[model samples]
Target: MTEETAPQDGPDGPDGPDGPDGRAARPDREGGAQAARPAGPAGDPGDAGARRGGRWRRPGPQQVPQPHPAAKGMWRGDAGGPFAQMTVMPGRMSVRLRLTLLYGLLFFMAGALLLFVMSVLMANILGNVKVIGFGISDAEAAELQRQFVEQTMRQLVGRSLLALGGVGVITLVLGWFVADRALSPLQRVTTTARRLSESTLHERIALEGPDDEIKELADTFDAMLERLGQAFDTQRRFVANASHELRTPLAINRTLLEVALGDPEASDDLRAVGRTLLATNARHERLIEGLLLLARSERELTARTPVDLAEVAATVLEHSARREHDNDVAVHPELTPGTALGDPVLLEHLVSNLVENAIKHNAEDGGELWIRTGMLEGYATVQVENTGPVVPAYEVERLFEPFRRLNADRVESAKGAGLGLSIVRSVVLAHRGAVYAVPRPGGGLIVTVRLPPGQPAA
Candidate 1:
């Protein structure tokens, strides 16, 4: 048989083609032709492929149905079905509001139950009254008495409902006030906790009132702050002591290395070794200084002066000019008046570190460096963007950590100490500002620093 009309291989082999019911094919009235098989259920084309012993496959990419515009803010289920739309979740209710509503509901329910009881009692009392016959028959007098009792009870229930409604409204207002008053101490605690930082940890809630749960909580918070302050104080001392102890040896070693390298009688090999030792000593010194600066910047700033960011950036640029030239990097500066409240020295260091990092991490060949400083959104801002090796977005955050570098060992890398970004973050945080870095679209990083605006010098 030709390939087009060939009997395809079946699970039962080509000799015996099975029908839909797994029975052997039967011959038609013509005797030579097979009987026509029924189409697969639901007329799915895949069933024909399955009957031919071929794997079924989708013709095109599956499409996902979009939710109806009216169903916005609501969850959707399967497409074009009865359960397509689901109810939107309700917004959160504050504890104070929830408490007030609960109180009013309970009071209103109790009032309703009391009113119901009173109506029952009144009905029974009125029903038992005996009617005296003055001018009518006993039956007529009884009917009049019944009408009188019904009217009196109607008036009683109507007045009572009105009074209960008014009382419920008043209770709701009272409950709201009570909830606010009760939660005031907690609000104080929250505010204090948010405002306190490493520098302001000495401030305490000191909530003074009748001893209650909230008061106890406030006292516990204050005690915790006390311990934190002590720990921070200890840390500050340790950093200071470590800085002093570490600097002396590094400084002495550098002086000795310089003295040895200066000797004219030294052989070329000895001089080369001395120069290498000097470089290593200088790297150690830089490391120590970076560590000390990082620690200091993590602490709270004790002094604040109005420092112009433009001036700081300009100064750092001037100092970094030689390095930029050496690296064959172009400088672009758009300095504007960006004044921030911070220590002048620390602010300068922050700017210097950013500039140095941009230059150091720039492309090996000539690259572009862009620096901008101005007031943005009521805050002084400094932004630095540069062209360099492509930095992964995921690795951007890790660069701020001490001794972290992308694809380079901290000790082996000539890049200074890997503490530049870490110190920048610490200084920004200490000034109650924010600093963040994102990978540039093409290459390098875009680092931005925002600080509180300071009043211009008069």
Candidate 2:
């Protein structure tokens, strides 16, 4: 490195010239390590070798995460579909509104493109015009060049718009045909899906072509329908079992009552018989009521209204206060104000059942209680909690069934038909609401009911 030839340092670079990046311009310790710099305006290539790290800039919504090694052979275009995912919106834009919007956009674009093409053609053909008339001389043409261009442009725009009107008519008809043809499959899917039910779940859409998304959708729906059919069958069996159990006691009591009243020797035993018969009748009535509650749960229709949940809770607590078992139980109502969309009568019945059940199972001597009712965002919920032994984990779910109670002995004596929770569930279901029972965190059980608010089913 003689002084004359050794690379000189400049204000912008280092001695041996490490240009702005601070990399060596000359060979490093390794013979292969020297990076050359770009020669100014001359095409000699140099150390502008790579953009060091963080060089290339992206414009929008970064998607730089490297693909997984396991995803070999998958195309890069799997990020999103051409259209948004198919959504089952209860409502959509009206057809007239959509058509008008599309046509308006197309009409504007067609007129603009035609006008641009016509103007370019006219400018090439006619040299210029003077004061609106076509000119021959170069001197006059030079003076009126801008004026002629402006006038010609106006004429071209007008002519192109006329032509565009014709194209617009054709485009509208073609667009309508294409849209209808494309949506025909969707229409078929809609028809097929509409026919689906517990019994008709076997109905399926035929895959007429390739195994596309729509085909996949039809397959998925068929599977869902099959599952529903199985569920309905199971429900039917349960109802049948419950019905048989309910009818037996009624039949026995009816036969016994008739036999006793028929005997002549029974006259002295009439008071005793009457008392026993009354007790039997009460038990029979309760059993029938429980069965009816279970049957009602499977119904799809309900009367709905704007119901005050707090008021219902208050009413239930009052009614439950009169229960023979509730004499010792103190009804503690949180009395939170709430509104729910449901049948007021049914909602009241639901609340009464929950409160009554809590009362029925309470420990002797004025048991503690917690009752709450309140509205949330467009929904309402009611919760009833009581101080009692935490229910067994396994038996909790069964308690909602007709004639199911933790203390089956207490319930079987006809004090309760074990149908209180069942009736609550039926009424809640009829309102398109949900009812569930859970053991409280600390101790005891809490029953909750949630219902939609405002728009109720008629």
Candidate 3:
């Protein structure tokens, strides 16, 4: 073994299981500055102890120093300090900054050019003149002329520079005010955009100014919002009408099937067929109900009440325990107070759908499910994790889309119309919450939803 690879121990040696700062240390692969024993080849037991010593050395290419995150957005022409500042994002430059710099530079250049021209004219005029005084020798006259020319040139240069400095300062100050005024409409546009949402789609920029580029932009933005509002209204109306029309027929069909199955004169085979029809009809009803709920949940909620997410999860678990038990899926819940402001019924539906999907698509035997609710990062959080077949990372996002399943085979066996996650996403969005799912390393998925906390009751 090389001397560098050989492990040594002494007072000056790498700290054993602790760092120089007296904290437990672990060897980092990047070889950061910590008192660690150098790491060696795999299956080497000494390397493990070296790692805990915080003195491990990595072999191979050195790691590059990462730039500070605050410095990442800086650009080539960005100003050095607070007085003159601009941010440069990729493919774009700050318009306000560009205008200010160009204004100041152009003014200074013009002033400098004017001074040069005036200086050249003055020099020419001085060069041709002589100091002609009575009883003066040619030498004396030449000396006096030289003095006049030197003094004139010096004064001209000094005064021109002072004037240029004053004018340049004025140009920069004016440029800032002018740029801000010219971009006032843009600020208004941004403010409106920040405040806009499904409920605030009716608000318009309505900029009152000259019919210039900024005004035109504001008008165009307003037109786009108008079109979007109309489209949303049309879609919402169609969904409402379709849901009512679809549900009536499904109800009638279910009633007819139940009546047929109840008939005493019905033959055994006929009764079996009637029972099958009833089951299929019930599935159709559920599919329709899911679609309707999904549509409603996509819209902004007009009314919100304080709700305990933990209680919602508890209620769902209670109702779903028997079903999970029948399917041999174990249910484990850690419910804590996670309160938020939302429609309680919709919150209940979100929890129920998550639990049902976890149980339904879980392992056929010895399945494990975890449901938890608590406060996380100042938000009410609900999380559900389950063990099932290996779910690919790429397919996790597709599960949230309507009528989408991991596999076509699962559509039949799981009896999932594939709208459970879709509804969950819609509800979460309607409540202004965030939902995420990640596949476990071994198998299954971990789903988490975070909603804003509710205000304390008066």
Which runs in model 1 stand beyond 4 Å of their true positions?
1-98, 130-146, 322-327
Clashes of each: 0, 4, 8
Q: Write the per-residue lDDT of candidate 2 for residues 1-458, one digit (tens) a residue.
A: 10112132244332112211111111111111121221111221111211211011111112111111111111111113211123233368745446655865777686787678777888876654344346457767566776667787787777777777777778777767666665567677776764444446566766476688767776777687778777877777877776777777777777777777777677767957766785778777766766665565544332446777867887777766666766787766555445666567667778877887787676555577767565422235566777676676466677777677885734566347888887876665555454545554334566656554543224
Candidate 1's TM-score: 0.73
lDDT of 1 by residue, 26-120 (tens): 11001111212212224333233335432211111121111112111222212232213322224768779998999999999999999999999
Off by over 4 Å in 2: 1-273, 407-411, 441-443, 455-458
- Candidate 3, position 220, lDDT: 98
Best first by lDDT, ranked: 1, 3, 2
Q: Which ten-residue region of model 2 has the weakest summed lDDT?
A: 22-31
List the lowest-lDDT window of 10 residues for candidate 1. Answer: 20-29
